[model samples]
Target: MTPLRQRHLTTAILLTLSCTIAIAKTPVATGTGGAVATISEEASRAALTILNRGGNAVDAAVAAAATLGVTDPFSCGVGGGGFMVLYLAKDKRVITIDHRETAPMSFQPAVFLDNGKEMDFETVVASGMSVGVPGTVRGWHEALQRYGTMSFRDVLAPAIGVADKGFTVSENFTHLVDQNTAKFSRFPATAALYLRNGKAIRAGTLLRNPDLARTYQTLARGGVKAFYQGPLARAIVDAVNRPATAPGMTVRGGAMTLADLANYEARIRQPVHSTYRGYDLYGMPLPSSGGVAVFEALNILEGWDLKSLPRDRAEHLYLEASRLAFADRNAYLADPEYVDAPIAGLLSKGYAAQRRALVDETRAASGPVAAGDPYPFQQDASVPLRPAAVKLQQEGAHTTHLTVSDKDGNIVSYTFTIESWGGSGIVVPGHGFLLNNEMTDFDFTGPQPNVPEAGKRPRSSMAPTIALKDGKPAFSIGSPGGATIITTVLQTIVNYVDLGMRMDQAVDAPRLSERNGTATDIEPGFATGAQAGTLARYGQRWSDAPEEIGAANALVFNPDGTVTAVSEGHRHGIGSALVQKSAH
Candidate 1:
């Protein structure tokens, strides 16, 4: 047999083994009432508690987000920022809140470079220079004030309780701690809190953060002002500006000030809207590229009969469409306030048709694919198309996502991040939260759309999406994978709507990512077999990677007034709850 045939035979054996192993897993749950899905069990339960207390989805989301700060601190907290895509069933509206972190007033494009060369990853990540003015607290406050029925104090109570009483550390948390012990040890506050005897505390150890509890209490009592304008804000600024004094660690501090925090406001923007198979999809708009990328990819794929194609061929088409979308993402998407992003043209079905024609079903586009001129389809046709910039460095996979829905039909999909695990490795002395390294999301060495600028929010790939069917909420889904977030979410939706899988199966299915890059990365099960050769024939380089795509959580609203929530099992501590409330 030929080498390709031999590889196929090996993959067949692997697929058989995978099928055997898959049979042992527990079945996904389905129920009625309301649903909460998050990366942590504690957070999920906290949201469910709020939902049970007659709170709307926004209230439950805030509660769950705050709880995640306590239980999954490494991924997100007050020190981070994120976007919330909210659906108010009563009003039948989709509101997207942009709480993405902004560059400090002192920021410049060259901040992450030394003598014109990009600084090493460690120098940038572990330094305060990577810190941005955190916007998550403000976002939580804004979300609650506008659409929630619960008070800030009520929503924060569970998180405060979690912080004060402590929770057992999971194996994943322990691994992260162990992995970054050196960086954590560089800062006194981080070292004191997370490390014991020069090593990470063992898994299952009940750890309490009294300082974070106090911070939560302060915010609960005083509201957003306490975090942005009070002593807590001062403490945050002080911690970020404090230099690392350890040997061989030459990373400098940041210039975040009280003004940066106080000036921060989470603005409400219209969600990016699109249609896929008669279902309306709404995603968080720029500085998040997720919604546009998904919209564009779906539009491109709409030309094909995806369900009728072979599974391998469908995967090939999906990868190509993703690449095309990511090309636009890298070239055009950015903070809308900073760039004249061609949003209209980018999402237009006409433009998508134009780009879709570039794809050859028999083979992938050879050579480096550049972004198309989408401005032609816009009303303002004078908008110029810039050459595609080199793809930015991949973001660390330390983000967290949650989806919540209440009995009243309110839904919220939120994706938050501190940029990386133990962001900046510098916890505030009294605040007990790590500062975000979100500044690193900006391009340092190029005239890219996401170049750092004073007070500008960095571009993001945090896609929180909700799909509506016949003007009724159908699904709310999102993931935490940095650059891979867009592809992961797109795949999940395709799996559910096109392939006809359950939400749980959609989230659990193998995923692939092609971020306008040369190679397409595929997860275990789907990477093997004749598909590899099929993809290779299309000039697509296949990378069989594992667990690097995303950990997506999704909730599907069934026709019988029931809901099913699924938390992908790849990440530890994932939890989903369905609470059935009686009809009034």
Candidate 2:
């Protein structure tokens, strides 16, 4: 059988198993007036445990996040980085916290460039210097201090127990290890933990990280400072500076200095704000183009009454909005600390009007069109990337997002990543986790746009988002795909409000993304093949393969009094559960 056909067979088997398992598990309580948390089952149970102990959503969120740090260590942990968007029901306030990692003050932009030329992907993607000052712990600690009702130590208990007693490695963890074995072999400490007897640990095997538990203990006793300035930091410095750590590339680890770790801090910033179709949308600020791009795409598509339009017209709207927003993303968006990112201008009606003018009623634009003025159009002129015209296929894997809402109406949506797999695979001994290779998130060489800069935040695709309808929190959504983060979140909201899909249907629905110039949908063999075919009738280039659609986890609250939640069926390791307000 052809490779595509073989994948279809594998997909069919997985889908059948998912359905069977979903049915076998008892349906959790769901609906109005109760709390709901959507995340991995292990994490969900931990949150529910907190709720049962009288913890609010903030408390439950802290619990779930800590549990994820232990069980899903490959994708996210205290060693990595993340961001959060929160909605408070009591006063009806929306707030965002930016805990994105920062480039160390000692970090040099030209460090990734060798002799004035951009380094190859291998050099840029893997190195100790590629590590950013981690911010996930500090970010979460600050959020809890300001908003949480439960003691921070109490929230961390579940994670400590899981780590100390050990937990089974999930299928997802196994896949990540397989994909990055080369990097794991380069770092002795990383290999010792993730690889057993010199081989990747098999799925379902119980894995323990005594070192990570020790790190968590330090934070629990001394706050986030312990990781940055205490023994943990010293141990990290020692491991990174060791002569054996760097691969035989042009660069080495002498760059990660002690002062860099001692001075690291995660910044807190205001969220990007906009109103779309009478609903308020709030998301991560600069360093994350998700907020502006999603808002722009939604605003552009708002002019069209998609509910009454045919499939083709709806698809046309999706493509046009993507093209405009993406052009803006590439040319202008960056760390506001480093660039004068025109957040206000990009989301302005004036900018939308200018972009709207470029959308033709029929036929795709012959080539990419740049968003004018603040974002001048640039013709891509490098070696022909096969899926030319559109943005490069952002590697699509290894991210996880969780959204939690409690009876008190406090809601939190958080997104996390270790970049790709075991990250750069250069673990600091005694730290027990991989550092993010987020340096690759920036352009290494350019006309100076999106290039790496010391202390500048790298652009991110994670878009943990929330919407307010009638002045009340209505939905929380996000996804796990390298660059498809914004598109997935935008599509989920559109599916819920525009298409009137329930949470499950919305998440399982087909998706399409366009940026720069190309448009892509879930491969034809995807469960939503019909949706892709229907979209193709408009303008998108639908691939017959099966890897293009993103995996989503989402939740929606209805005015009619129901809380609906869903996890993507195709996500081999994902599961969603809800504990509604009115559940018996």
Candidate 3:
């Protein structure tokens, strides 16, 4: 071996040894029946229960997701929308579902702007105008009808039970409620649902939402029609249009009509596919840029010997790759129905090669790099490439993710959101669920592909992903963290596959994210003296704050038919396995 190759081999060996020794051993929940991982323990348990009861992965996913809506209401609910990535083991095929929220047909691009100026930040967040026509309920119904073996009523039972019987408020729930007291107080129904005696309910307080339970029950009994066309739909519209009168403001409400709700539909789109180190990666496609971005970053990193590099250098490379990927993400990714995103070009190995050539190993790219031209690599030149435009919109970290797998080999990775905590702070009067401020996901200020438009789904960062090894399902993973979701998933895959970390260690490892920015945000433990200095040489400004990067959950399907599931403990996530007990 050459001197350089030998040196790299030695360094890799040493680094691996150090990392193995440094990482604290964490237990991996394993079982033969199935596995469930999620942000809430109750949700994980609900999924496991479904798996043990002969439910398929799809059924368990729906049950777990529904439970999360009840247990983690501040993050996601029936009033929101999300995406799901599923692997049908029987068919050996992958499916992606896009239930992302859409702008009302009456909505205009300037809705969030006043007289050509941006509206007050508070108004944009708390007002009815921020609400989008919700699609979560419809999405759930579609998943059950198409892929699930169980009925909608059966899948929703756990969520309904939780909502009706009530659950103890978790510390996270209490903290979020306390933080949003001002906004929640603006809406009487919201305050009544979450607060008591003008104070945020403390942790351990038994909180129940009978109205939400009734809504879920109505859907269970009447199906999707109950939510999209019946009383619940009307209640949503009226509540969104109801004017708010605060002490110093009278914010006008939304223009969501019954037609908007009636016309809402969840679509089954093609999953974005790529290969990294012989592993086939599948992610949700647009209106989510996550899959494309992750693929792009992976494609770029494929050219490097990450294992040969020192840990800090490896991290620097990751940051640079993410920056390049996000630059393209900001410019091109959007709702494919409304915008001509260059899917073929973006995922092409040739295009990735071109983008990879632009990376500087010794220094970071100065300033924000403009999106590259990916159209030249497209096979079909019939559709002209739209000019790229930069879109800057604030996104929150409030969201939930769940992953489930069954002994049948089926797998599900799902991520859902309401845009922000207590989304729009508008509870549909008597419904007890928060409406999504998903409209804020659009770029109102920029003339971009993701600009708000009638009948257009907002661009999203919800990426539910699955990876396969040697033509068998290996991992089902996803996370909840707005734009950071892509980077989080990418890092976990890198940690597990490239760095040779165990499944639990991969999910628990410290993470860093750089979303086309000069500053690289690192979790506290990962940013320190020598490593920080090495990254600084690459022109990376460090932000050591514990940025809520993402709460990722993953399930590793072993070749022997057993499954290992892991949840990021730092985020208070939980994992459970449906182990079959040998006859006692």
Candidate 4:
């Protein structure tokens, strides 16, 4: 949620009014056909290049995903991890893949604690303890092996070319590098790879990753094994376990071992899907609060007279729904393997009505709202909180997401992350990027329930979603903000379905979210200045002072069989939508 302080309201209001525009504050790409999609602009261009030459959606998606790995490396790449949701029209079915990172075998709970305290979040985030088993490779390869029509090598050729020739660094890359300059400087290898002669790489500068290119080559030949079981894995283990360059510190370095990578496997699982206003909404299951919370919010809002509310009132609804969803998330959401996530009870209309009754129309309810006793599926009767030893880092804008739907009616929405900015700033030798400090994404101390443990997945905010309206694909979208992803996406959907807006209008619409106990908005003009008093009245506390809530990219299908797409107005990620004339 937004981090606007009371004093900042004056600035937020001024910025919001001045920046509000008929056009999206960010660049958006729109097009049309029966098959519609929004992907990275560069990736979209590359995919279109492949499509015009006869590639299908799967082919285009592969190409787009690969290209994005190079251009949007800060958020995603071969080094990081993500999940993919594929809807294959030919089969008339949906498939979900869990390539999320795994905790290393050496990962133990006590390491992250500080004398029984958990304040060393900096150490957890920077040291080997924070790393998890990387999964992007396995996930991407599985999709290709199971359903893709094109050769893996062929699909990745464009990325290989870009990496080899060295594409000019985009503004987004430059900005992230500048933002995380300190973290990047902490490690010699990281400093050597990203920084140029001790200076940050600027936009338009040609950046090459010969090492990454080589890794990609290995993938082109060996598929997922190139990373999971080969030299790269060895390098990762060595890098994490090696001692820091600094003098004798009690903590040697990292704890990750080769066994972690060698034994790690990406699981193919069923998506946590539910029907929302006739649309089949499919999202990641456990470990991600996206699917369940999003469903809960939408289901609850469905009961309200949303259309009758004024714009701000609608915003209030967004805030309320967000609050309810986050409450459930903090209280019960977790890996299904570890805990029985109250998915059914949370999404049930009957249950939502009970929860909705607790919301005050005029102000936010103070403290957490009880989930109205318990539904049939909800079993554990308890309030959950991360102890003082546990610290929750606000969602980091350190990831990238893409949506690709092919002419064959195959749709894929993928979200990937390195956690935050180059992730721990520790690079493996011969690997272009650093390992993800995803362990920091989890609660590190305090309550035993929140402590890091072997085989438990950390909770994530990545929400790559697809909507099927009237039993057909309507829109596919997702974003890269921690808790805010759920809210931004919900708003976009409501704008189209309820507000009678066109594709562009719906996507470019202003956004608000209250997930994680705060109502937030990008003070329109400032894009970073946030206001929380409106939500504060509802009992949500403001903290972290949001710089950016979430960045969303979306695609909408026109009744005339056209398409419109948009990217976050405040940042620099390309968004594109395309339509095919026929199912060629």
Candidate 5:
């Protein structure tokens, strides 16, 4: 058999074994060699396969991310951008890679405006003008080149096979497509791939993307330059400049050029750091609101003896802390180079202590809370403070997260996105990939900090995080839920570190997200498992979450010298947790 057929056979065997193992394992895997956790079994398998082949954490993570692009395309892919937080075991330090998509030079403050008002999200989301310069491909290349053991070609092989041979369509995938059927039909390329004979493809049917497979091959052979400078880049620019919209559809085209695509570069940045009960938390820095926001929340929670509080009491505090942190997040966090975000002040314990004083364990704060001033805590005393007026809007809660580790102990926690599901509703004609609508993440109506501007990356809540104990990676955790991502990570960490829950329990525990909104959004199970009645006495208001709060994946380095991989059990369907060697 040919190499492609061999990979297909291998994948089939792996799928059968993975199903059997997953059925017995309960979305939790324990082993010694390595561990991988993700929202898709195929993605987990891809990363595990790499780990079994001696690829390090970076290599496995890149492989997992590439496979997620194929299996979880609506949420994240080569067309989008993301943040990767890595724990370098040998160096005993944490670092981050920021590849958040950038607005084109031609974009201006009024780009999303019409007749002096911000255009409706629906009116702009499906248009080419919403597409940002894609950074996923370059970002992947950068990680692999700098830290991975395998070449890009080698690492991409599994995803290419899956795309060529096809994987089974999932129920969640079908539902997401159903929601976007009308919007997707407006683009011929998008319609051709997602719809079968002009209708949504049913779950369990095999789906293939030969075009994407070929595109991956092109990148494998020509490297990142092929994606940024050659035919693929031209095709992307063409699609953005003048999309292949179906007849009767009308939308504005983008101003992105080959130069914009060519100039896109991923940055290696410092990870935001903090301490929670002696454990050090490291996460993506500026350009993402997740890291600092989560750090700030954790610092506030540090003042409470959550380990001694009742479930409702501790959870109420978590909700209040999140509210305060988001208040600051909306006001001060953005792309650091563009916005002089008081990063030092925001992460300072003094700032958190002052903010924490606003929390009342007995009564919840009312309304959208105002942002706090962190300028006093700034290390640079002479730096002026920006006004802390608050105005906020929600972002699409669709994205993907994955975690991976190798035998050498390096860990990677990554979160990636394309803004909304079925991003831009335009697949690159023949390239078989969607372009990111990340530009829509910009605050269309905002202060100077986060407003649309040339080369500015819109603020993100994609917090990929790692927690260290005694200068070693104790665990890695992350999730995908737009603004709720910070709360998800914070709650999970709190559940594990403070409440003494196992890794699986920490991830599966009921979640609550209060982004300084008027009412707290609760997962359906939030009340059932906790002291449900008394929470309202604390003046906690409730709004039912449309579905679940977050589908998170995590890895725990047990003191016993074993690694535990955990994923969601039911949210967005059962996620997959894979280990090279299963404990059972």
Candidate 6:
């Protein structure tokens, strides 16, 4: 359900304006031919339109992601970057693409420090120091060049149309806008685009971005180089270094040279591979902690017969496993270019067994738990053991996700984001897009795994996963919630694979996020469930989440060869799940 703060207005005019959009934001669809699932109906339509035009899953994914830049601007756009996990049907191989944002080459570890003291987080978030060089446009270019069946112009047409013609703003958009009013109002470009007379637009208002459409057209005409090497690049750099602030509003500028943009490239990386109950799973590799952390936790849980256990007992184990995995993740994982993550050791079942031994089913472990040593399992006993404890860091919950599949069995699971709502709060003048605040994702304090460095990608928790049952596509799932993303994906897979719940049931089930914290964050449904009291007796402390944990989209391949696409029934204003044709 939409949060109480986002309750829709009861007025004939507003309802009519919202209904006029024509596309229904249906939360679930199971059908034949092809399928697309995302948080917005406009984006779903964009993907379906591509599928109908003979584009492959890779093409459809790019289309949906671009459309989301228009419909869900607060979360993602060309101004951001992300990870993509794709399955090529013809090749029968699952590969991952890493297009995550990178720190500028001139960036230093002490960027957020003053007189050896860390700056206030809120101030740093809106300054130029927070911006990361974006990798989205190049990432899309790579995906299309590698596997797509259509031209960039063809896939981009849908998003351009959506941007030129507006969609009715929903309660979710209004809520996000209201939440970021102070930030948005600081810049003339951002303010003029989102606000009306210096105020947030109401739900059902028509929101258009001709500037973004024109920007898309520019890319269509000049190609990716136009964005990375020319006027667009200059405009982006100017916006970062000399932020356009409202009179009397002061914000720090950042140092981002055109060299940073031109030097950017999306790389093809090996997917993080593991197995559960005979199912082969693939996830995005480092720079992203999602795949490794999920694997470690699942390996720990695999020791138990969760299917036969009672609900409370099983959930207690789930929380403990997540806590332990996060402890390891915080201490060890970061940008692979800068740190040699112990990939071999972290995913080893023997290491998981060691971690699992510490979990007492009867009582929750006190946190922050010390990160375990996996060097022995890595067969590199000479490597020094890691520091015992690490601080818990939280990332922006403002990211977007989508999943797509073609009739040919190709699939793409993607998650992308601008660092925070309104990002650095500066929009590129003439061209329209937010610059990412992703630099702030790094640790401000010293001697940590995720501290910022030149050309290093910050650690991310986006786990876009594809699983194989008998070496065929079984399911593709992902979500958008900072650190909670790992737990959401892990818990959903557990719900479907271990608990035997339907795909939709797994997506809808109440969420609990345990990141080696003193208390796990729980959704209202979980806190109110009958088993909540029983779990508490096991020493599982609960803290109600301010908003739902994750907005997720998924698809399951059935035994009969049909695909089931599922989205949240209510979270983030009812996500859209659609297929090329209805099952009935």
**Winning model by lDDT:** 6
Which pairs clash inside model 4?
2-520, 4-530, 26-569, 32-563, 57-406, 114-117, 364-538
Model 2: how large is the Cα RMSD against the reference?
9.6
TM-score between model 5 and native: 0.95
Model 2: per-residue Cα lDDT over 147-230, one tens digit each? 776554566656666677787787777876877777676777888888876577899999998887777767766776777886
Tens digits of per-residue lDDT for model 4, 381-471: 6553322221234445577677766656677787878787677667776667677877776666534343467867777777788888887
Q: What TM-score, over all chains together, does every model reach? A: 0.92, 0.87, 0.92, 0.86, 0.95, 0.95
Q: Kindly provide the TM-score of model 6 when superposed on the true structure, using C-alpha atoms.
A: 0.95
The TM-score, computed over Cα atoms with residue i paired to residue i, of candidate 3 is: 0.92
Whole-model lDDT, model 2: 0.69
Pairs with backbone N, CA or C atoms under 3 Å apart (clashes), candidate 2: 33-581, 34-580, 34-581, 389-518, 390-518
Clashing pairs in 1: none
Q: Looking at candidate 2, what is the lDDT of residue 543?
A: 41
Off by over 4 Å in 6: 1-23, 525-529
lDDT of 5 by residue, 455-527 (tens): 9999999889998888777999999988888899999999998899998999887777888888877877666
Runs in model 5 deviating more than 4 A are 1-26, 525-532
If ranked by lDDT, best first, what sequence of candidates would result? 6, 5, 1, 3, 2, 4
- Stretches of model 4 off by over 4 angstroms after superposition: 1-40, 243-252, 367-373, 377-393, 446-450, 518-544, 573-584
User: How many clashing pairs per prediction, in order?
Assistant: 0, 5, 0, 7, 0, 0
Candidate 1, residues 361-479: lDDT per residue as tens digits? 97876644788988878888474756655664667777989998887788899999998888788888877888888988887777888888999998899999999999998898999
